[model samples]
Target: MNFLDGILFALFAEADKSAPLMVPDSVQKANFAETVRKLANLDVDQLLQNLLSESVWILIKVLIALAIYFVGRWIVRRIIHLLDAVCERRRVDVSLRSFLRNTVRVVFTLLLVLIVVSTLGVNVTSLIAVFSAATLAIGMALSGTAQNFAGGVMILLMKPYRIGDYISAQGQSGTVREIKLFSTVITTVDNQTIYIPNNSIATAIIDNYSTADVRRVDWTVGISYGDDVDTARRTILGMLAADPRVLREPAEPVVWVSALADSSVNLTVRVWTKNTDFWDVFFEYNERFYKELPAAGINFPFPQMDVHVKNE
Candidate 1:
C-alpha cells in the first residue's frame, strides 16, 4: 500500500521468479559433493582476502555508527544538563521543569536513535512511518490516558495549584505531593496517599486552601436559655482577642446569637487566622470553650422532658 511496502513486494516477486528449485538425482548429488569438497580445499589466504575486500566498508560503517551512538549519547546528556541549568537559572517551578527536562531528553534520544539507524543503512522514512502508525493506534486505544496527559500539561502551564498546597478536588482533599504526566499524587491529613487522574482534577472544581494568606474559622456553641447571653458573647470575644494567632486588622472576631434552638440559644463565633494556624486555632478554641464555659457558669443545655401524672 505504501511506497516501502510496494518496493518490498516487487523485490520479493522478482526474487521468486529468478530463483529455481532443483530435485537432484543420485549423479547430481555425487557431483555436488565433489564440487563442495573442491571449494573447501581452496586457499585460505585468498578466501580471507576476498571476504575482507567485500565486507570491509560495511564493517567500517558499523564501527562508525557505534562511535556515533556513544558520542551522541554523551552529547545528549550534556544538553540535558544544560537545559536543567537554564531552568534552574530561570527559577521555573520544580514540577514543570522536571517534566520539560524529561520530555526534551526523550525527544533528543529518539532523534539520536533515528540517526544511528540511518547510518546503518536502514530507511529512516519507513521507520518513521511505522512509528507514526503504531503511535496513532496506541493513542486511540489509550484515549483516556491521553486526555490526562493533556490535562497535566495544561496544569503545569497554568498552575492552578502548586506542590505542598492543600487542595480539595475530585471528591478528595490532600496536600499535593507530585504532579505527574497522567496523575497527581496527594497525601491526606490521615497520612493516606491518593492518585487522582489529571483529567478529573483539571475538569473538577479545585478548592485550594493555601491560596489565601488568611482563612475564616466558624464555630457554633449552644448555651442554656437561663445563662447570660452577653456574658457568653463577651467570653468568646475576649478569648479570641487574647490569642495571638487570630487576625484583628481587616476584621475583628464576631460573636452574635444566631438562632434560638429547642433547648438552648445558638451563638455563632467567626474569627480570622493565618491559613497555617487555622486548624490549631480551631481545635484550641473548641477545647478552651469546653473548659472555660463551665467555669463561667455557662451551662450547655441538653434535651429534657417534663411529665405530669394524674389518676392513671
Candidate 2:
C-alpha cells in the first residue's frame, strides 16, 4: 500500500473503534425505568414535611387576613362614631347627616375588603378590574335608579326641602318625612304616604311653604250690586283685627274693589299671618264673612236673569 492508502486505513480503523453517536432503544428504556424507580423511592417523610410547611404558611396567611379584617372593622366603626358626633355637634340636618354617614361607611368598608384581600396574597388589581366591570354593568342595568341616587345626593347637598317641610313637587303636595338614598318619603294632607323618586323631584319645581316665617292669605268676597260695599269691607277688617295670629308688622289687612261683575261686585281681602296659622285663619274667616256680611245688611247675589214673554 502507498502512504495515502495507509492514512485512509488508519482513519477507518479509528472510526470503527469509536462508539455510536445515537443511543439504542433498549438503553433509552433502561434509563427511563431507572429514573422512574429513583422518583418512586424518594423519601416520603421529606415530602410530607414539605407539604406540612406549605400548609402552615397558608394558615398563617389566612390568620393574618382575618386579623386585618377584624381590626379594620373596628377602626371603621370608630370613624363612623366620630363622624356622627361631629355632625351632632355642628347641628347638621338629619338628612345630610344620614347620607354622609352611609356614604362614609360604604367607602370605608370597600377599602377594608380590598386591603384584606390583598393581605391574603390576592391580586388586588385583578379584583378591582372585576369590581369596576361589575359596577359598570349594574349601573347600565339600573340607569334610572342610578339617576335617582345622584339626584338624592344633589337634593341632600342643595337642600331644596327638608324633613317636616311642606312642599309641592311633581303634582304631589305633602310634608317631607324622610330623604332617602333614591327617594323622598312624604305624608300627604290626607294621611297618605308617598315615595317620590329623587330624580323626578330634583328636576321638578319645588314649592316650599314652610321656608318663610309668614304667609299671605287671600280671599274673594262677592256682594250684591246695590249692597253697601263699605259695610262689608268694615266687617272683614274688624274680623281680621280681632285675630291674634294675624301679623301687622309687614302690612295691615286691606280690602280692595277688584272687579265689577254682571250681578255682583267682587272685593279682594288680603291678610298676612304666621305660617302655622295660615290655614286656620283662612278657613275660619271664610265662615265668618258668610255669616257676618249678611248680618251687616250686605247681600250675596246669585246669577239671575229676567225673562220677558209676549202673548200674540
Candidate 3:
C-alpha cells in the first residue's frame, strides 16, 4: 500500500510540474465536435450520389450556353444579311460582299469559341496568345500568297478590269475569264489559259481593248525603192476599199510612207474596224495586198546580197 501511494504521488507531481494541456470547456467542446461533424468530407459514393441527384442543373447550364450560342449565330446571320442588303442599296461591288461576309463569319466564330472555352474553365488569353503566335508564323510562311491576296483585293477595289473583258495585263494578253481572290484566269485568242497573280496584275498596266467598240488596224507593206510610191499607195487604198469589213468615214484611210529601209519604202496603212473583226480584217487585208501589189506593178522588197567575184 505504501509503494502504491508513492507511485501515485510521483505521477500526480509530474502531471502538475508539466505545462497544462488546454482543453475546451464543455460548451465549446460540444460546439467544436458538432462543427467537425458538419464539415466532414463525403465518401466518393456519397459524392456521386449527390451529383446524380439532379442533373437538371448541369443540363440547364449547358442548354443556356447552347441557347446563347444559337441565338448569337442567328444574330450573326441576320447581321450578315443586313450588311448585304445595305451594300446592295449602296451599290457596293459583289466581290466586296464576299470578303466582308467571310471576315464577319470568321471573327464571330472566333468570339464564339472564346465564349465556349471560357465556359469550360479554360484560359482564353493563353489560347489567344498561342493562336497569335501560330498566325504570325503562318502569315510569314504564306507571304507570297498573302501578297497575291492583297493584290487581288486591290484589283477588286480599283476596278481596273473585270471578268469577260479583253485585256493585256502582266505580260499576258487575253480575255479575263475569272477574277478570283488570288489570281486572274484568262483565255487567250489561241485558246491558251493564262493564270496571272493578282498582285502582278494589280501593279501592272492593264490594257482593256474591249472598252472600245472599234480598234485600229495597222498594215505595213514594203515596196522596192524603185517602185512608184504614188501608184503603190493608190493600189493599197483600192485593196482596202474592196474589203467591206473596213470602217469608212474615219476621215479616209491613212496611207503614208512610214520608213525608208535598206532596199524598200514601208507604207503604213491604218484603218479602224469593229473590235471583233480586227483580226479578220488584218489577215484578209494582208493577203489581198500581197496578191494585188504584184498585179499593180509594185515589187515587194527582199533581203539580197549582191556578190561580185574578183577574177584571180
Candidate 4:
C-alpha cells in the first residue's frame, strides 16, 4: 500500500475501539487523493473567472479616466481662450491679463488631475494632503520669491507704474520694459537692461516720471554780475515762447533771479512741456541759452584769481 493508504487505515483503526479495524489501505488512499483533486479543480476554475471579471472592470475604469482627462483639458483650454477674448475686449493690461490666464490654467489643470485620480479609484483626500504638505515646504523654501510674486500682483492691480513709463527706484532709473510675476524689467537711457525684484520696487519709493501729461523742466542760468539780468531773463523767455511744445495756459514760462552767486547772477528758468517733448525741449532750451546769451552781451562768469605780491 501507498503512504496515504497506511495513514488512513491507522486512523480508522484508532476510531474503532471494540474490534480491530479491517479496511484496505489502498481504497482509503485512492479516496483521499480523488477528493483533494476535485477541490483543487474547483478552486482553480473560480479563481480564473474572478480574475477575468476584475481585469475587465479595471480596463473600463482606465478608459473612463482617460476620457475624463481629455475632455476636461479641452474644456479648460476653451474657457481660458474665452477669458482672453473678454480681457482683450475690456482692454485689460497685458501683464495682469497674462498672469490671470496662467493662474487659471494651473488651477484648472490641478483640478482635472484630482478628478482623474478619483475616477481611477485613488484616494483624493490623501493626495490633497500630500500636495498641501509639498506646497507648504516649497513656500518655505522660496519665501523671498513668494513675496516678490505677491508684490507683483499688487503692482499689477494698483498700477504704480506701467510699461513704457520711466521710473526711478532703488537708485536706478529706467523705462519699464516688462512686468513679470517676480521681477520688473527696465531699459535704461543708455540701452542697458536691468531686472529688479518686485518686492523691492513695491516696498521702496517709486518716482514715475511719466505719470503726468506734462512735466516741468527747470534750468539755472548764471550770468556775469555786470550783465543785465532783465536781458538774460528776456532772452530765456523768448526761447521758451518760441517752442511750440511748451504749454502756456496752466502756467507760462517762469524766469526769475533765483540767486546772486559770488561772481554771477543765477536765473531760474522753469517751463512746462508735454511729457513726450520734455527731453527735446530741455536740450533745445539749454543750447539756445548758451549760444544766444553771449550774442546778447551776457557774459558767463568764470572763476578768476589775482594776486598782488609785495615784499612780505
**lDDT digits (tens) for residues 1-312 of candidate 4:** 543454456445434356446657986687577666655655566557766887898899999999999999999999999999999999998777767887788889999999999999999999999999999999999999999999999899889999889999999999998887789999999999999999999999999998999888899988997889888888777877887898995799999999987777889988888899989988887888889989989998896666898996
lDDT per residue as tens, model 2, 1-312: 543454346434423336678878997687667666765776778757766887898899999999999999999999999999999999999889877877889999999999999998899999999999999999999999999999999998899988899999999999998887889999999999999999999999999999999999999998998888889889889988998988896999999999998778999999999999999999998998998888899999999787899999
| lDDT of each candidate versus the true structure | 0.87, 0.89, 0.79, 0.86
Model 1, 1-312: lDDT tens digits are: 644454346434423344347634875577567666755775778656766765886798899999999999999999989988998899988778767776788899999999999998899999999999999999999999999989999899888998889999989999998887789999999999999999999998999999999999999999998899998988888888888999985789999899998888999999999999999999988999999988888999888677888995
Model 3 residue 67 lDDT score: 79
lDDT of 3 at 228: 95
Show model 3 residue runs off by greater than 4 Å: 1-129, 242-244, 248-251, 310-312
Q: What are the TM-scores, per candidate, against the unseen true structure? A: 0.76, 0.71, 0.62, 0.70
**lDDT against true structure, model 1:** 0.87
Error of 4 at 202 (Å): 1.4
Q: Where does the lowest 10-residue lDDT sum fall in candidate 3?
A: 10-19
**Model 4: runs farther than 4 Å from truth?**
1-78, 93-95, 112-124, 305-312
Judge candidate 2 at residue 212 and give its lDDT: 92
TM-score of 2: 0.71
Best by TM-score: 1
- Model 2 lDDT on a 0 to 1 scale: 0.89
